[model samples]
Target: MNKILIVSQQGLARSTLKTALYGEHIVIEAGSAAEAMARAQEYRPHLIVLDMDMGGENSAEICMTFKEHDATSYIPLILLSEQGQKDDIINGLHAGADDYITKPIDPIELLARIDTHLRTKEYFADLEKSDLLMLFELIDIISVTRNPKKILDIIVEKVSCYTEVSRCSIINIDIDGNLAVVASNDLKKNQKITLDLKNYPEIENALITKRPVVLEDLGSNPLMAAVKDKIKHIVNESIVVVPIIKKQNVIGTFFLRTVSTLKGDRAERMNKLCQIVANISGNALENAVLFETLQSNKNMLENLAIRDSLTGLYNHQYFYARFEEEFSRAERYASPLSCMFIDIDDFKKVNDTYGHIAGDLAIRKISLMLNQLLRKSDIAARYGGDEFVLILPSVDQAQARSLAERVMTMVREVSVPQLYGQRITVSIGLATYVNKNYTSYEELLHYADAAMYRAKSAGKDSIFVTG
Candidate 1:
């Protein structure tokens, strides 16, 4: 049912394969590598059995040429070499041989290898159809979510479920060009999981090739010699690294590590699924990143509207807006509401004598002291130039007057070192809402303003109270 190409320079080895494969397959024999390539181009055999020792180009070189050819790469090639040519066998495998058979090859063993490759091809064909359906499901999942953490979790979960790897991790390349584990499943405890592209040449190769890098066994790789002990201590067996590509750049990596060797069909399946997840996740991640940046910018713009530029206190407009809400709450609860109108004593003289910068420094210091002194529920705001307002929700006339005296003492002690140790003082006017007289916010504001004028007339640094 399948076409098999036998490539051997020796007539004896070629006849041996043809006799063994006779009626089972349509056996096509070639006596040399050149004839094998020409017949392979014409016949397009399902599999190739090449003799390693008796070849024009060595079996490994021929294997590499076959793998590099676009048309012949998919056709599985098994190398037949001498009994003790272990090095040549390894070289052949590295050159991309699907399987290897040794000379004095048993007829049953060689046929079994052929059957394995054929079955694997059939299994992969089925997996392709199923993988296509899975890809659509992944695309649908990406469409509904904008949260980056949520999306990454879904990716890790899906990859783990679809491909039964011992452990899986999605390593993100951050803005700083460092790799961090965004999501992982079944990661080893106490394992120092660190992967940098610079440190791992195999991983770097995967990124550059934009393809999967499969290391069937870490023990056999010379390139992994530097990190062999470290890898053996951690993963030790096999790892499949696939690059998550976006716009010709590797944004991240999908790593699957296992104790079992990943080879042939299993490796191909994992690589295919990795590419699917990488393609779908790249755009979803980008969208989530953009959304986070936009949200941060939006919050900053909203803060700019209500926050004072210099003192970092609430501005006059926002103070009025908050006052209305606090006033309504106090009225509904029948709570005592008090407001203090504070004016800096001789503020105009300070600005003229010390300069505007020193005046700003004084304002900032006062604001910082207010923030430290005020209760969480109390509101403090810069009403306008050289004046501030405080709203206390549950304070009566007696309490307001006591608080005002303490504030007067504190303001007098508030000296600005930047202004040559200039001491600042303030005149306070307090207004308490009486049960029926101060029914409206406007009435309370007017009473506080009147009290402030009275305090100014009586003395520059004093407190005046009105109900």
Candidate 2:
């Protein structure tokens, strides 16, 4: 509830003023300037009503004292003057009284004026609370995610939801001065669009000035004249562009467009909020950029560790790790698992006739073929020079044989440009673990390898199977 203080020398006047504000406010009364000051300091009232009819003391001087004092300066003061006391009202106003009421006070007018000031104060308080809440939420988002794009997208979405704008976007400017929409509430996921700087003069101005630029009217604003005709069909009524600065440089902008014209406190509140958000965004974007760089480098290093650099397939170590996991899963589920060992026939001949580079090219081509033919559940990796391994889960002997024949057919069709139209073939050994006595993945792989040598002894291009 709001608090009101009434100061008047006459006890009757104080009672009258108290009655006027009764029930709606917590009213305190004092009969002298000194007592009023003491009561005001104690109560910290939202408003003060001072009757200028103090017989001896200077009421205007008292109002000025209250206005000048740091503790009471923010309190709204209403001066009550006798009828036709124009000089007194003028003096009270000049002494920093917020409003005036001529004697024979009307209760309705008193309530209306007081309510106006209170409402204005409340509006500003709510705006402050909202701004703090938004900043807290943005900080939370930054702490939880390392993906810069995800962070930018969430920021734009939250801003749009809070501000109720027609469109809200985060634009990034590259070192070459190229502008792109990095994240926007209006766009699809992962969608990005390049922008022509000339079309967005407000954003350009904000960048150039390293400050905010607001276009209240798109049609009449001089900054938007170049694109007025181009955007005639757009429904946006205003635009606000705030530069995101980092270490004295403009990295990007927060671009907002509204369908309704913002005026008075609405406009001021929006501009203030945008400026604050831009400030927070500067630091948030910097952290996100750094985090993204580190994350990218970490991923690249991990990829190198687990992948074969030459053929882009799983390396020997990764294959063994995955094979053991798959084998355990198949054993636990009582599911069939097939292992295949493949040796390229006469691979050394290609290297001798052409070069090692040609041999590497042939290996890459075969790897690509294997990748294309394998199911999502199948795993293929280059085991060593001229050798490849495969793991097919839930595949029995018949299915394994069918897959081996398919691989043989594809190998015959493979042609390396470096080989000068020389066709390549592979000898594949297939083993199924359903009825085999193998106790470990290594035993299964060894059996497949031994079967591959038997196929080699039988002929160069063939398939050998063992349980």
Candidate 3:
């Protein structure tokens, strides 16, 4: 509904205006120019009605003040004066009144003029919003990138900048009814935020029924009486929640909150726009999810070709390819690079005593430990049977030796239940590149392997470092 502020010192005229506008609009009555100006700033009414005889000397100043201020300048003002005051009408227009009506109050003429101003304001607002929502570039990017979260972040940020709302958020609702805030204008400040719809009955009901929810006057709505106190932090006066659905499934919701109330045609237009946005958002999210699934499948197929079947670690062939890449990068950067060749101590004896199943279990356990103890830049691979290799970039001889010792200790302490009472241990050989002594990557691997043989011969379960 459009808001109209009536500034009239005469009680009879104020009451008459209220009676005419009451059901069609929300009317704010002010007895003086000071009160009217205060209400204009606070409520930001759509149209302001000023009485020329209302506030003595400050009356004309108030009209000029509203016109000059950014917040109130767009609001159309109509001056009310005595019938024969030609000079007063001219003065009111000069002070920035959009239109003037001479009184003894013609109700029909006043109502008609108010209707014209309100329609004009609504039309302009629609045009501005339409321009804001026409984001062809964003839609095209979402189609090309398959990164929905990035697009959603852009959507939330742009929507907040363009809209009249205080806050805008896109929430993802899971199958079990858990709400996760996927994208929002405040994501950087509040990470991984979630809300329980069970606490917000209005929203919960909307989701259940698959419809849009609007709290036009949140503070005064009796339906929200039970949760009103709790909602004060959530919304100052109004909010709208539109569901985003995919393939007949309600996946998420778009939320908008406001400090001032929205009603009637304004609320209706917002609802329509939100529905269109929700549809676009829902389709984008679905495409993102589908793309992620397809990518995961593709990655799994590639991994099967280059990963150890038992441990799911990179196989020897893939490890050799990665080693060349890392070696070249380290040489160019003149960075410290280290390699470790690890062998399971007496693994043949364990397999003969316990069976092949126990051997596989032990291998899997050690592979997991390698992953857990290593940094993201460090690469670990299952190099053929009962052996593993590690590429530790930016690690020197001392650091490599220390890491090898830690791994040896950890492997010794591991007790595989499948191997019964037998404890598992590993012997490691470490090699570092001080000044690229090895001409080829094969020479580096051979040096690490020779050191591993020395560790095994030196009564196993120990680390041997070599250059």
CA-only RMSD, every prediction:
29.1, 29.9, 29.7
TM-score of each: 0.37, 0.38, 0.38
Per residue, candidate 2 scores C-alpha lDDT tens digits across 178-257 of 57888888899899999987787777665544456666757887888888898786525766776665532212334433
Looking at model 1, report the run of 10 residues with the lowest lDDT sum.
248-257
- Comparing 1 and 3 by TM-score, which wins? 3
User: Candidate 3, residue 294: CA error in Å?
Assistant: 6.1
Error of 2 at 42 (Å): 99
Q: How accurate locally, in lDDT, is each candidate?
A: 0.73, 0.77, 0.74
Best by lDDT: 2
Q: Model 2: residues >4 Å from true position, as ranges?
A: 1-298
lDDT of 3 by residue, 1-467 (tens): 98999998989889878887878789998987677788998999999998887646556788898899998999999998875466778877998999887655555446656865666534545544443455454466566657667767766775566656566777765433456777777668346687876556666555544566777777687767778778776454566777665542212334432222557666666565565566566777777865765686877557667877667688888899999988888888888789899999988888667654356568877888888999999989988679999999999999998898889888888766546578888888988876877766777889999999999999988888885
* Candidate 1 Cα misplacement greater than 4 A, ranges: 1-298
The clash count of every prediction, one per candidate, is 0, 0, 2
Candidate 3 clashing pairs, residues 3+ apart or interchain: 1-263, 1-264
> What stretches of model 3 exceed 4 Å from their correct place?
1-297
Worst 10 residues of 2 by lDDT: 248-257
